[model samples]
Target: MDQTTSWGILAALAALIGGFLWEGGHWEGLIEKTALLIVFGGTFAAVAVSYPASRLRQIPESLKTVFRPAAPDVPARIDELVELATIARREGVLALENKIADHPDAFIRNGLQIVVDGTDPELSRQILEFEIDAVEQRMENQSKIFESAGGYAPTMGIIGTVMGLIHVLSNLADPGSLGPAIAVAFTATLYGVASANILYLPVASKIRIRAADSVQFMEMMLEGILAIQAGENPALVRKKLTAFMHTEEMSFARKKEESEDGTETEQTQTKRA
Candidate 1:
């Protein structure tokens, strides 16, 4: 699980509830189920109307993407690319046909297959680039689902509050119940605003961040695949892909290079010189 997101949500709720209790607010005052149904149900309905069910189905997977993000091993990817380049350069690109059929990443596997089939370099890059852009759009649209919910949540809350206030105003005979009724009505506003800020918007932001990282990782793969198709030197492939590495990836690359016995390829010779 993503500790940051989980802890962040917990801390926000703790501060809010703790502060409310500290201020002499009753715990029962915050548990307005009617208000919750209004905000959440209405917000969900609005979002369902806003996007087709086909897109809405992606919400569960998008949340999973945020919470259980795949940490791509950049250095490992570069190593694989370099190894593939070596084989393609030495044994000809077709030599990779029997190798990448079952490659882990669908992106890399499909890309290498295209190259093995002797697709033109320019056409290959276009095909891969198009795939990357399409993926980014799809991921971004998924985040927009939450963003739309966030946008609608507060309005739904307000509508609930208005409905509650309407009932409160109609039953003005009991002044004794006025205070509790008004407070209950306003819980809709609280639910709407709080859920938007603490949950929907935050989850949307997290999804976007994950999406960006996924696209960057795919771009790295794209570059590696293209370079391999071009018959670039394995050392050069490593050099090109290294620029895409984050700090932790750089550390991994250094460790892998250090463990080698100066005979893996020209990288050892390059390091020695």
Candidate 2:
């Protein structure tokens, strides 16, 4: 589970509800079944009309990705790839075959299998790169679905609000109910705006981020595998793959080195003293 996404959603809901209560608004005033049905149902229908049946089926999985994002250990991946390169350099490329089954990532495993099988370097790179592009396209499609829903949600809410206003206007004979009716009519607008900004749009953004991360990781793996196939030095492979690490990862490495240097200096001073 992604704690940031989970906590962020919780924090947003808490702020919205807490602010509403602080403003002396009753929670019951926000509960309008007709408004909800109109906004949510209409939004879904609009999205359905916009996308194909096959793409619609991916909504569940895409939503799951929003809450439970993939957290790839990039540094660890680079380290593992370097180790694999070392093994391949020490033993022949065929030696990697024994470790292929033990490799956890299917992408890496497939690449290694291709290398072990003595596939043409150009062909292997082409195949892996194609797979990478395909995966990225699929993820982009899924994210776009949510993005389309977000775009539709606000308009659906407006439609619901208009419907409610029509009913309210028709019943304007009772002046006493006008205030409550107007309030109820606007609830659809609130639902639409809130759901779009807080849920749909954010989920689409998260999916995009996840997709980018995935593509970066795969690209790194492709480079590593290709390097191994080319019989590059393990140290050189490590240097090249390290470039894929995020800035934060690089910062952490720098901090770790500084701490180690300080520790060594302190030890030397104490011994000299």
Candidate achieving the largest TM-score: 1
- What TM-score goes with each of the models? 0.93, 0.89
Q: What is the lDDT of residue 90 in candidate 2?
A: 92
lDDT of 1 by residue, 191-235 (tens): 999999999999999988987888989998999998888889887
* Angstrom error at residue 51, model 2: 2.0
Cα displacement (Å) at residue 116, model 1: 0.3
Task: Give the winner by lDDT.
Answer: 1
lDDT of each prediction vs. the true structure? 0.90, 0.89
Model 1 deviation from native, Cα RMSD in Å: 2.8
